[model samples]
Target chain A: MQIVLAILVGGAFGFVLDRIGATNPNVITGMLTLRRLRLMKTILLAIGTGSILMFGGQMLGLVEVGHMSVKAAYIGVFIGGLLLGAGWAASGFCPGTGVCAAATGRRDALFFIAGGLLGAAAYMATYPAWKASGLLADIAGGKVTLGTVPGSAYAGIWAVSGDLLGIVLGLVFVLVAFVLPEGIGGGHVQEMPAE
Target chain B: MTLDWKLGGILLGAVFFAAVLLVKPIGVSTQFVILDGIVADAVSPDFITQTDEGWTSTNAYMAKSSGKYAASAAGPLNYGFVFVLAMAVGAFLSSMLRGGVPLAERRAPEIWRANFGDTPWRRYAVAFAGGFVVLYGARLAGGCTSGHMMSGMMQTALSGYIFAAGAFLAAVPTAMLIYKEG
Candidate 1:
């Protein structure tokens, strides 16, 4: 039953990602460079909408706080995130989008997937060294929320209600998404390179 | 068959919310590690062993979480792994239903062409290298964009916001430097 649900859920997620142009390297790079704001707007709107729904649902007891999974805060995570960003800009494909692109018949994505596997293997080989580096040690309260939810295991960095904070921030993103122009300078038409 | 970005974004949010509400958050990077572990165990019989105590690995990282990683690798049919595989299937199906990949995706994107030329091999090489770097970083950070930024921030986790800041701090400058023509 769970596997079936996984297929349905995963399918919906990938389908939405592709439709949003995330499977296209051009779309990704375009967003990164601020040359095209379509994908960026979509991403922000999605995150914002999801946040509002999630936090709102939690507050209403329609969502389970226990299901919330907070990743541990560590120096390695910050460093690794920087690295991931560089790579994301270079490749224009993150892990999920890479897989989805390959399914869309983008041959380049297959190579990306291959490289990702090799990279994972390399990390596995060097896991011990990373562990010894102390970069993975917990920082702040490892696995903490910015604000407290009633039933979660994580500590809150602030005394405010996390649900309310999330909703407010989500609204801000949604507003930004709507107000942002397609391109800077009032959607100035830039000459796109020849296809 | 194509939806506008606004509708697409909303649907994406709906999917994410439903997943988190029903089961758990959506994450993809750890599956890459799981794939690696599965292959390693296949090639080296002793890499993973199942005892009465549960699954264990000679590799310390895999052996952590009370051998949870090793168990997933040994089983290879868990929820996360299946979800990733299904993601590919979903994408393919979406393309097919839309009458195959759109022309924009079939060839090199215009911006890439503007900067990198129209060589397929070069794009493939860069794509691979980029994927490698991303996966390595994800493992080190213990999550990827989906796991950390999207799901994490949705839950109002401070780590998610920090990861987002770190990502954009490097990504914007890197993108600007590489695609100077754009």
Candidate 2:
């Protein structure tokens, strides 16, 4: 039953990702370089909306805090994130988007998938070294949240309510998405006359 | 035809929200590791073995979590792995339904072409390199964009915000450097 739900949910997730032009490398880079804000806006809006719904649902008791999974905090996580960002900017594809793109018959995505598998294998080979490096050691109390979430095991860095903070931040994201221009400076998108 | 950007964004949020509400957060990169384990196990019987307790792997990473990963690797039909495959299938279905990805989209993107060239191999190389870097970094971080940034942020995890900041700090500079024309 869970596996079946995974397929249905994963399918819907991929469908939306493709429909929003995320399957296109150009669209991704365009957003990264600030050449195209449409996709960026869409991404921000999606994140914001999802945040609102999720946090709101939690507040209303419709969502289970126990189901919320919090990743452990470590120095490697931040450094790894920076590396991931560089790759994202350069390749214009993240794991999920790359898979979606490959499915769309973008031949390049196949290579990306191969590379990702290799990368994963490489990490597996070096897992012990990384574990010994202390970079994986917990920091900021390991699994902590920005604000206190009732019924969750995580500690709050701040005493504020996490649900409220999420909703507020989500609203800010949506607002920014709506206000952001399509392009900046003399990019191609900016060359078009305003509506 | 593709959905409108605004509508698409809303729908994307809805899907993510539903998944989190119903079961668990959406994530993908970890499955890549699982795939690697599965392949390794298949090629070498000794790579993963069934213990009295459960499954165990010669590889320590897979052996962690009480051989939970090894179990998934041995079985290979779990929720997370299948979800990733389903994502690809969904993308294919959507593309076909839209009468196939336009030729321009199926190949190098405009920004890429403008910055680099139309050579397919070059683009493929870059794509592969990028994928490699991202996956490696994701493993180090213990999560990817979906797991750490998107879902983590939704859960208000401090690590999620930290990861997000680090990602953009590196990404913006990298993008600026690579696509000087754009």
lDDT of 2 at B61: 89
- lDDT per residue for candidate 1 within A1-195, as digits (tens), equals 778888989988888887777887777777777777888788778889999999999999999988889899999888889988998999888999999988887878888899999988888888899989998888998999888877888898898988898899889878998998876522222322223
Highest lDDT: give the candidate number: 2
TM-score of each model, in listed order: 0.94, 0.94
Model 2 per-residue lDDT tens digits across residues B64-168: 889988998998889899989999988888877777765654676666767776877898899899999999999999899889988887677888888999888
Quote the lDDT for A123 in model 1. 87
lDDT of 2 at A16: 81
lDDT (C-alpha) at residue A3 in model 1: 89
- The fraction of correct interface contacts reproduced by each prediction comes to 0.73, 0.78
Q: Quantify all predictions' global Cα lDDT against the true fold.
A: 0.84, 0.85
Model 1 chain B TM at 0.92
What TM-score would you report for chain A in candidate 2?
A: 0.92
